[model samples]
Target: LKFVCLANDGIDEHMVWLIGLKNIFARQLPNMPKEYIVRLVMDRSHKSVMVIRRNQVVGGITYRPYVSQKFGEIAFCAITADEQVKGYGTRLMNHLKQHARDVDGLTHFLTYADNNAVGYFIKQDLVAVWRINGSVAMFRQQWMLRTFALRRNSQAESKNVS
Candidate 1:
């Protein structure tokens, strides 16, 4: 699998990923707009990366640079249903973080995720910055410090032990 910068030619596959995410969100929220998926795809900034497997788009992460906050917000992240638990999501996220650091001049990343996704971000070393609605909603952030250091150290330790 390789990461690809989605172009107009890949919009159909991009819509598939978008629809999958929209369906998942609608099941939880119920009143989500039917056009929400398309809108997200259209509004995505240039920083988005699509994960492609055999020329098929399977996952993606969208980010927008914030000049005022001096950070980048990970607006949308989704992996296909058949592709979950295969490390694709993590790769997509890591790629996004690298892009933010190297290209966007961002040292911090923030996101608002649902309950099911909270643990995933937390496992990535993102800290809970705030919780809303009695902890049902969460806002999380990660800095380019302990998180990256720990990840690098863990990878090194694994290699050493091997």
Candidate 2:
């Protein structure tokens, strides 16, 4: 397995890249335009990590580093069904966090790793920091502190979205 950090790629090339991602995690991606992905890929404040096996993208994670906050954030992460339950997602996260810690100076994560994904996220050392009234979940974990929280994205449900 190899990892690629996507950045500054051309739009045409990004669109083609999105096609590969779409093939494995179809409909699992965030509800956003391809242009948004291109934007993320180009943004200097963000990072997108893709896990490739045999030249195909099997999993990926997008995150942003915070200059004012103490932790970074994971905006989204997904692994193809065929490649899941094989510790690949955890491996990707470990690599992602190592990059953030080594290159970005981030030590903790501020993310919402859905209810269905709580167990997995917990295993990755993400603590349940808060939950928005039992909707979506929130997480925060530091290598030092041991507090736990469950996040909730109430607005996500109100918006009638999954």
TM-scores, all models, native as reference = 0.63, 0.65
**Model 2, which residues run further than 4 Å from truth?**
9-19, 22-26, 29-44, 129-162
Q: List, residue by residue over 1-162, the lDDT tens digit for candidate 2.
A: 887666445567554554565444334554434555555545666667778877777877777777466567676678887778899888887787778777777666766445456556667765544333333322222111222322223122111113
RMSD of each: 8.5, 8.6
The numbered model that scores best in TM-score is 2
Q: Total clashes, candidate 1?
A: 0
Candidate 1, overall lDDT? 0.54
Candidate 1 off by > 4 Å: 5-32, 44-46, 129-162
Q: Give per-residue CA lDDT, model 1, range 1-162, as digits (tens).
A: 787544234467766654544454344433334465445545645345777767666767666677466676665667767777888878877777666666666666655554466556666655433322322222222211111221332321101000
